[model samples]
Target: MLSPEADAPLRAAAMTWLTVRSNDGADPLPRHELESFHFEGERVPLIDRQRGIRKPAILEAALSIITVYRAEGTTRPYEDGTGSDGLIRYKWRGLDPDHAENRALRVAMERRLPLIWFVGVAPGWFQPVFPVYVAGEEPQLNQFALAVDEVFGLVEPETHLEAQLRRYVERVTKQRLHQPVFRSTVLRAYTGRCAVCALAHRDLLDAAHIVPDSHERGEASVRNGLALCKLHHSAFDNRYLGVTPDLTVHIRQDILEEQDGPTLLHGLQRRHGQKLMVLPGPRSQYPSKELLEITYRRFLEPA
Candidate 1:
């Protein structure tokens, strides 16, 4: 095992390599980009296709953890580590605590080393969350706690502060975990097109929530989301645009009547009272009409 002092540089280089490839997590990395990291004229793999945990021979601790995605119709091969307590519960590779993979993750926890989490957004497509730490282990449960940041890594699970920390962690989890998955899932259901304007550029589109995420009924699922381009997303969130239960788009009456630039004229005013340009192929994946009615009612309220 490499000493902690010796491992620091390698870890930094690996993180730098990952940052460049992922564009700091704004873009998903393909399998090839995630396959390996270059260090000192040698190639070190970042993940293992057959295993969830990966530990390079040269590193003293685990390098990364992966969560594979099973397509909508298929059964998952393993239980995914989406923790209920706002921290990830990564299962042991097998029943053996002495197993090399499990030991590597344990070493990561003991040493406070940061690791990467590669979550499958789609088949062969991954969204990377890096610098995560193995916070604590639950031997009875055969799992380890994975924290997104240093503060969370230090807190013991189920402490007196647990409730407060959980609330904080939940907020962080929504940003660091939920949103990326939510976006990818929603866009896939809509076939990567904006519902309102049918913009096909994936990067420019957003997964918008029909019932605001703060609401008690808000769910981060495809049925609660609409794929919209950036402009339409902003408009919908601001009540400048609204969509009824029947999937008809409406721009606010005052905005529709205002004389503005071509963008306002063609993009907003022209789209008033039109049906959504695109929708999910499966009826089940369509945005919930009930949720749409809730937001539309809010949109209709005096602004």
Candidate 2:
């Protein structure tokens, strides 16, 4: 808990820190960075160590809420889930809606205060989403409705502009909530190595989609992704490099003939016709051949 005068400043400082981190491309912030947040020479934890809801001793509303990730087939402490209406459903701390933690959340809802939601992407990593509001509450269900965008706090959409805004919000919410998890899962499957070049640096690797997300079949599943280094990811995206359904690497003819430096020769041209340097240990985690065929055909087409 912080003094009344310090509370607002601390929250503002946390938000600024989060913005800086995001601008620096630190998605799915690690636990160490979250714990290291300091305001006025004091360490103020943005996340609670044991509780779902975090609030100070003061009578102000809740500061934030979190949803921890449990491994597949394991039991979860809360029944939190996304609603059919496209809003986030956050479960109460206990059955009683008036419990201190729960009440703090409700107060945040009534006051329309923005909050940070640290969604666990992996065991110790989290994706920080900010300025999300507790837009609505359902006492009977012992839960609250969270709006990823402020427009959700407005009345139901009745106009074309409002309808478009609603669609945008839904898309943004889905990306913010799902993208980090997808990256973590894909990277884990490949053991944090680039499948193309066998690079082992997790920070320099990306989960490249075999088929782009805009396509109807481009689901965010491990089977539709490949862990690639930044350089290879760009080449794959630009069609300079293509991987066939049989898992052979192909460099575009123009790229192979280019008179570039060692990077072009050793990094890409040499990998041509070679089998992927790394693959997921689990056979079921392999990239989907059908999707690869589609992507490979697109690569063969004139860009």
Candidate 3:
């Protein structure tokens, strides 16, 4: 087997190869003849004895290091006195190494470390790597390769690739949840109909988050959304209106009792009460009952 130190160059080579393949949408160059692949306008020298060097093991280690750099935004030298050069020179090291970090790294490599690293680096990349299995002759590309491309192309050597990767993942995964995406999902869910009045007018529709975005753990998944018109979403968020745990609409009694309440209540009760905008999909992704309950209780509180 190749010494860990000797593997570093191979790891770098693999990353370069994967990046080239992805950019060109082509198959990776053959492993034994990898030196035929150009990197930075130059061909890397081939190892004299390919049999003695384990390409996958080298790739896995490189992937692990890249992943950690992407996730932690820092380079940590291996604990066994091995330097931060991407090679694990210690042949006697156990598979289940005693080091916590090393163990974590190993786990990440064997069990979709690239996916997790990609999620931290670029969540939109998740869709490509997801379901982990595909129905075709092409082998699934390693998910880490996505982040590796970004790191090699965009990141500074000293910069933590992990932090950048995390930012990318967050950006892509949540892209649809921004004002535009949020609005689109909501509008689509409602089919351009108002949640309150059943008013099927495109111009009047609004997409509203059932749970405020700030409180959400994941990016705005479709289930956490609703389609209301401008007035209802405003009133709903301001606690002037609320949805029941069962998704029924309710106008707050206090709002009805305020000055100008007669006009507001008359409009709301006539248009919205006892009705729900039927969600587009199965209720599983619909606003959670627990979330509705929490919003309802907050609305009912003496403020």
Taking the tens digit of each residue's C-alpha lDDT, what string does model 1 give over 36-87? 6767667777878888889877777888888887655565655656466767
Which 10 consecutive residues of model 1 have the lowest summed lDDT?
A: 150-159
Q: Which regions of candidate 2 fall more than 4 Å away from where they truly are? A: 20-25, 36-43, 72-85, 139-142, 149-163, 174-177, 180-193, 198-205, 221-223, 245-247, 252-264, 278-294, 297-303
Please, what is the TM-score per model? 0.86, 0.75, 0.43
Per-prediction tally of clashes: 0, 0, 14
Clashing pairs in 2: none
Worst 10 residues of 3 by lDDT: 129-138
| lDDT score of residue 144 within candidate 1 | 88
Residue 167 displacement in candidate 2 (angstroms): 2.8
- For TM-score, the strongest prediction is 1
